[model samples]
Target: MSCQHAPSSDGNPTEADSLVIKVVETSAAGKQLSELTKFTASGADVVEITIKPNETYQTITGFGGSFTEASAYLLNQLSPDNRQRILEAYFGDAGARYSLTRTHINS
Candidate 1:
């Protein structure tokens, strides 16, 4: 697979702060397995993955926080199919939470 660095909004090539993989030769299943293993082993302690269609950049927002936690939060808010896909890709698990904490207060 060939990897290319993404450009910033200003059209300048940005320094890569994270590893980006471009799948070329691998089978879809193999690619998924490899990607999952690599991300899991990155020693990031916490990872946030934003899954979206290649045509759009509007999906989950990575707070640059924990992937597990962020994913859980997303599951609570997203459709079942989307939640399941993300869970399977990241944690290899699928379970939804009904209760979530909100920081807002009534004035």
Candidate 2:
């Protein structure tokens, strides 16, 4: 489902908020719970895995990749249609939904 783009108090369209992604299905276990699955190796090896959700651990900030001037220039040189496609492919709900992008300061 698409999110509505609401105007902020400053009267500017909230583009970021409009990009909210509704998750229909996910691999994550239930809230505050974990899922266990078994694995079998080549022949004689067998293993059981436990994902403990109750355990408090370091929370993940997000996933992302680096951005460079070369990458930016490539994107900028693309046609508008192609540029939009690339943007959606990386940032759209159907895409990777990356939220934390990092870039190097040095060339």
Candidate 3:
């Protein structure tokens, strides 16, 4: 995912801004997909997707998951080595790469 934001001429962020976002798909075939279409005054049914890597409209903070009491209990029951493996599986770069997480209070 990519986003692009246009800044105001006065060097200040304004409520009225221009933003364009595009989705980048990863595939084993190494295929890149992007399309551009112009809309007519009468309106068109066709839809087009445009990809611009240099353009960014939004910033992603993080990806995360929640931890439940049941899950926590199960995890704590595991051995230290097993616990390390589970943590790495979720937070590791080769895994889901979860950057944010939450645990319910008193759960």
Model number with the top lDDT: 3
Please report, in order, the local distance difference test score of every candidate based on alpha carbons. 0.47, 0.62, 0.75
Tens digits of per-residue lDDT for model 1, 53-97: 356756653222233555456678988898767655544434332
**Each candidate's clash count:** 1, 0, 5
Model 2 stretches with alpha carbons more than 4 Å out: 1-44
lDDT of 2: 0.62
Judging by TM-score, tell me the better candidate of 2 and 3.
2
Could you tell me the TM-score of candidate 1?
A: 0.22
Q: 55, model 1: CA deviation in Å?
A: 47
User: Please, what is the TM-score per model?
Assistant: 0.22, 0.54, 0.49
* Model 3 lDDT tens row, 23-106: 666667775664333233234753444446678999989998999999999999999999999999999988889999998779
Per-residue C-alpha lDDT of model 2 across residues 1-107, encoded as one tens digit per residue:
22234456765544343333232433455533232333223375633333355787898988878789899889999999999998888888999888877777873
Q: By TM-score, is 1 or 3 better?
A: 3
Worst lDDT 10-window in candidate 1: 98-107
